[model samples]
Target: MRPGELVPIRDDAAPRVVERIALVRAAGAVPLVGDPRWSASHWQQVQDAASRAEPDPQIAWAAVTSGSSGRPRIVLRTAASWSSSFPVIADLLEAGPDDAVALPAPAVSSLTQFSLAHAAEGGPRPLLPRGRALVAQDFAEATVLHGTPQALRALLDAEGSPRLRAALVGGSHLDPALRARAEAAGIRVVAYYGAAELSYVAADHGSGLALLPGVEADVRDGELWVRSAYVAARYLDGPLRRDGEWIASGDRATLRDGRVHLLGRMDDAILSASATIVPEEVEAQLRTLPGVRDAAVVGLPHRTLGALVAAVIEPDPDAAPSLDDLRGAAAAVLAPAHRPRRWFMGPLPRTASGKPARAQIVREIQTGEWVRLV
Candidate 1:
């Protein structure tokens, strides 16, 4: 395939794949681009669009990775390089032919490859045709299931089933309450951690998150750095290669008991005078409070403290609780640094994938839109 080849692509996969194909084309590498959802004529349109664009001789192979929200950036990886991680996922999931799997739409994520491998265990496992119609009935016989945290919650809520032996949760943080429910229902829910840059770095078995074989990770100065076989070639916008190896992730983590516990992003940490405030720690404490359904804690720019903690929370509608009462509940178990000095009610802004939109909310606060009602 030469640059601007009109390959019929399908939207059935994550948007990242399409973006990757585009990046390759932009770099003078040819790609036949078409959305699977589109007809032949539409494919022609895509091809024409690519054909008309001026090509750059030196385009980086790195794909722009999209988080749950925020801007997407390039992360270079060859098809062969990304596929190497799949077999490990296959082994971890123990996917078999008899094992049916239910996947959310845009099923082309790195983790979803586990389901694909499971289906392929037989000659060809039937893919649950793309749609929002995936219900308990859809996967009554499915032994394996995979989805983003929010997607899984919706599936479990609308059709909580007891058939699965294993479930993979990723693309965002998993809520403790959601975990407890899935476990109670006889489903072994595993929290998966990885970025588009590296697929399936670690996953929880029935026991807990264990680093996949051959993947190494370490915490330095409270930030997580990963050296693995799955890393991409280079950033789409920047030069390929840094130092020698290893990408310094924005995530902050702690290495305890031979496992990495993610502690939010290092850039988002609030440096208030002498004390460093971790907003996620405060948010976690708030979520444990009675009547708090969902919560996000962020630092509001402050004149003296440098940054002060501000919490935006969703109260359980059934409880109809007050902020004072919620704070009182948090007081018993939370330290002062973990308490929100300011509180706002209603839904927290989340990414399309449903992680808290901390960056967006922080911007709103800085612009004086997120007013403190309590």
Candidate 2:
């Protein structure tokens, strides 16, 4: 079987390699069995956990990359596929065996591979299952801390342990203000960019995100395309469009000098009555104001306009900025159509990956569960 090819093994499957061999035989494909570099026992444990979770193992040639599409699913990757993506990540982070990094996210996610691969020791330096509340214990060790933006925010709130010297924030947008705060707090937070398909293409290594070594980034008609060592083989569902060596990334980006400034994903853009608006643009402006710890911008259905911009902000407890003040600030910096029509101040919505859940925000707005902007 090819690397990342799903072999249907149930939770009760045994002797993983041997069982997988049999399964592959049954499926009429040759099986590679195991890789010595990563632990077989660990692989068995992972397989067992996966089987227990899902009774039917419908193996596929490719894996699905979720989160961007709003569903958690696996995408296919070959041993070569992942290998092609690693060097750029290593070069971007300037990583080596000496680098000790704390990865709060699970090792399974493509999102965490940059941290996992760079650390060399691999896996969680120490896994601390977050209880009902986040604890600061995780950041006590390791020079590099990798977490999603929300995870960083919560960790900063719960522990704020300024222990870790540098951070790599991913799986969501890193607001400039938040990045500034982390810098001010003595933790250098750099926002890295990648999707499951392209493990890591670029990161904010300099003033803006620098394209990782072995990666090519360019924008076409406002959509971003990445030709890199890291692009995945294919999606489990189907093949993804590729232009020559480059993969069509759904994200929108602007390449300035050698760095790229990412706008939000193209699908997330909201078309109001007057014009199309990117919520991130509005969110970025809102985040600059004082008292806004975290923010999520979403398009909610409106009677007249197809969608109205809504700002859901998590206010800092110590100093909360007034809603009117936020609106006024938006008015000064943004165009009339670009400003959010309503502001909802509360704890922001987030996904399991620690990225803001725009889908959840839309759902809440539709169901009237979310607080109305007054």
Candidate 3:
């Protein structure tokens, strides 16, 4: 291994991923880590793509985005870009030498891999699972946790991991209802809004995501643009857009009272009857419904309306919510146009990183049979 050399590290084992990433850095090579869980061909596609990527001398890490919608993207950043945030994040998350971060998720995700690297550099010790799925034993020594909303919910449902004092959640929206529940459990939930490409945007310690130090942000045409010393140097495909020092975050948001309110990905907007509906805005309200666990809103094809506002929900197993129930709850919070015209209930497709897979759900709804809720 040499500086600027591309080293392919194929291993999905959580412990090994941490070890290998640290090892690769010491050897001065860019570790292009692939998920061993991926089929050989899929991994090959990633490796082949990386082969053509122009080498960067300062690059220390390379990772593929969780391709939930389309082709996964390869991103690059220097080791210091992440290390620079550790001291601040440690204070924000309340991480200490006594805290052990339990990481039961797959190793390939940006958040997971980042935590591994973070722990190695004295953030917190990472408690990795020895098996494919997390069990009670995985969290025995853990005190603090970082996960997506879905993963956090799973942790709450499962037994053990009792030592958890705080949870640092990201990668998707953390429902206000869910955050309330976590607080009731005596856990300090700190939800942060960020992109894999743009590492740490803003963090919320129960209030709302305010800009972290060293990060500058603004809104233009309803989309968020950020300029920070910590952002990724470039995407493996090409350079990121920069207007002066700021780069478009690709998220629709509003800057109200110095808080960053993420609507959703710019691409997740639903066009129904000439109105633009952000699915996240609706989904957040829907998740507050008593029986709803998670929700995904999409533009379902309709001959008369072009695309109807459709909602696919992962309902609570104990009490499945009806379409009328969701409508009634959403009436006060959401506009009539933003309300879901049609409803569906199912397991709700999700990506590896645990975000709702809108693209896959659209495909399944169009071709496959989902239990439609009336």
**Number of the top TM-score candidate:** 3
Candidate 2's residue-wise lDDT over 1-374, tens digit each? 44333453322212343344445545544222222222333345434433443212332222222211112234555445555554544454444455555555543344443343333333324332233244567555555577776666666676545556677777655667667767777777777877777767777843888887778887999989998656766654456678888898888889988888877667787756424566666677677777888888888776435568788888899998887778776665554556788778788779999878989888887797877666
Please give the lDDT score at residue 243 for candidate 3: 88
Candidate 3 local distance difference test against the native: 0.77
TM-score per candidate? 0.56, 0.55, 0.72
Clashing pairs in 3: none
The candidate maximizing lDDT is: 3
TM-score between candidate 1 and the true structure = 0.56
Ranked by TM-score, the better of candidates 1 and 3 is 3
The local distance difference test score of each candidate is 0.59, 0.59, 0.77
Ranking by lDDT: 3, 2, 1
lDDT (Cα, tens digit) per residue for candidate 1, span 186-227: 777877777666556787654555787768887777877787
- In the range 46-88, model 3's lDDT, one tens digit per residue, is 7788777666679987777644211346888888888898887
Using TM-score, rank the candidates from best to worst. 3, 1, 2
Question: What's the lDDT for residue 161 in model 2?
Answer: 56
Looking at candidate 3, what is the lDDT of residue 350?
Answer: 88
Model 1 scores worst on lDDT over the 10 consecutive residues at: 63-72
Clashes within 3 Å, all models in order: 20, 11, 0
lDDT of 2: 0.59
- Better-scoring candidate (TM-score), 1 or 2: 1
